[model samples]
Target: MNVYAKNILRFVVIVFLQVLILNRITLHWFPEPAGALFIPAIYPLFILLLPFETPVWVLLLSGFTLGVTIDSFMTTAGMHACATIFMAYLRTNVLNALMPRNLSEYINQQPSIKTMGWMPFLVYSGFLLLIHHLVFFSVESWSAASIGSLLLKIAASFVTSMAFILVYILLFTRQNVARA
Candidate 1:
């Protein structure tokens, strides 16, 4: 399938999975005071999978759209949108730092474990997930929750989200698909 068609499919699938399935999950390891640890989010996987050559404007718009879609369902105000846009804004810089010196080679490709290799792709995904979670949890806990709570939320959410994203890529993404 073409990149556009493939990304469209990914967009729908990731959103649905996130809203219908993942959003309902609330992991808790601590007692009453510390209640739910975090919510595992996989929606950002869509933003991360956009074509490497996608422009910054498109990235920001798409990220906002995706986040808003999730927000409408998840009822988190604009938290998701804000976090997603922040991550989208930093995507190019993160990619450039993680990628090899030869830019032309990866221009038309998607950032994936296959194309970028395991280590670089892992680092790229980790960085984005951390940033995304930091923004998300930080905003959610802004005034109401304590700094410790915010840090715990960020840590838990990041690990859970990263786990889901890695598994999704390993199991579903066409790792061996032709690269640019």
Candidate 2:
């Protein structure tokens, strides 16, 4: 399939899953301190999957749009937009830093375990997820007035988001490898 068509499909599927399925999930064991961190916000995966060769401006625009879509559903104003754009800005540098020296030729491809190896790919995803979750939860709890709780929330949410992303990558890795 064409890249544009595939991207549209991915966007639709992920948005549907996120808003319809994941949004309904509530872990009673570890509820958000401020009730805003339960939503996994997996829509950023779409931004992460964008082709590396895509223009920075295009990536930022797409990230902003995706964030806005999620914000519209979650009613969080521009929090997601702000976090996503921040991550988008950092993506290129992260990719460049983690990529193998001799494998720079694959700059046009969307990053995956097959393209970047499991360790680097996980590190990249984990780093971005941490940043995104930190910014998102911090903004959501801007008036909490407790630095300790905020740090704990960020750390917990980061671990939770990493688990979600790791499971997602594992589940789809086979399909991605088959296609490649």
Candidate 3:
């Protein structure tokens, strides 16, 4: 199977999950107001899974398209698009910083638990997720608001999104653990 075809399929599946499943999860499920304070974001997993050698222009375009698609469904204006584009832009820098200096064999491969090892993959995902959340909430809160509440929302959502992302990576990203 072609890699791009598989990635497109993943893109569809993730968008569907976000729009149909995760988006409907109410805040009332958690403690009284905590639920209202947090909304897990897992859609960024698609962008995070892109090939390591994908070009900057491609990344930005893909991110924008994905974000716009989600925003259309959620009717959240263009906040998703903005955050997603920013996340995509930062992905390369994060990859360079975390990956080993030797890049001979790693080019064009997806960063997965199996491919990059657990720690590197975790750190990479964490850093990107943080940037995504920060940009997302900052855009969402770009209005008259309370600083404490905004921070609380960002913090709560960031934690939930991270936990959800890690679980998703563990379950979905092909892990090629080797036995000694």
Q: Give the worst 10-residue stretch by lDDT in candidate 3.
A: 26-35
Better of 1 and 3 by TM-score: 1
Candidate scoring better on lDDT of 1 and 3: 1
In candidate 1, residue 59 scores what lDDT?
95
In candidate 2, stretches whose alpha carbon ends up further than 4 angstroms from where it belongs are 28-37, 101-104, 175-180
Using all chains and alpha carbons, the TM-scores for the candidates as numbered come to 0.91, 0.87, 0.89
4 Cα displacement, candidate 3 (Å): 0.9
**Superposed model 1: Cα runs more than 4 Å off:** 35-37, 102-104, 175-180
**How close is each model in CA RMSD to the real structure?**
2.9, 3.0, 2.4
Runs in model 3 lying further than 4 Å from the true structure: 28-37, 102-105, 175-180
Cα RMSD for predicted model 1: 2.9
How much is 5 displaced in model 2, in angstroms? 0.8
Ordered by TM-score, highest first, the candidates read 1, 3, 2
C-alpha lDDT of residue 114 in model 3: 74
Backbone clashes in each candidate structure, one number apiece? 0, 0, 0
lDDT of 3 by residue, 1-180 (tens): 698999999999989988898888744334655345455789999999998888889999999999999999989989999999999999988888888764445766788877788889888888888888888888887864566666667777877888878877768855446753
TM-score winner: 1
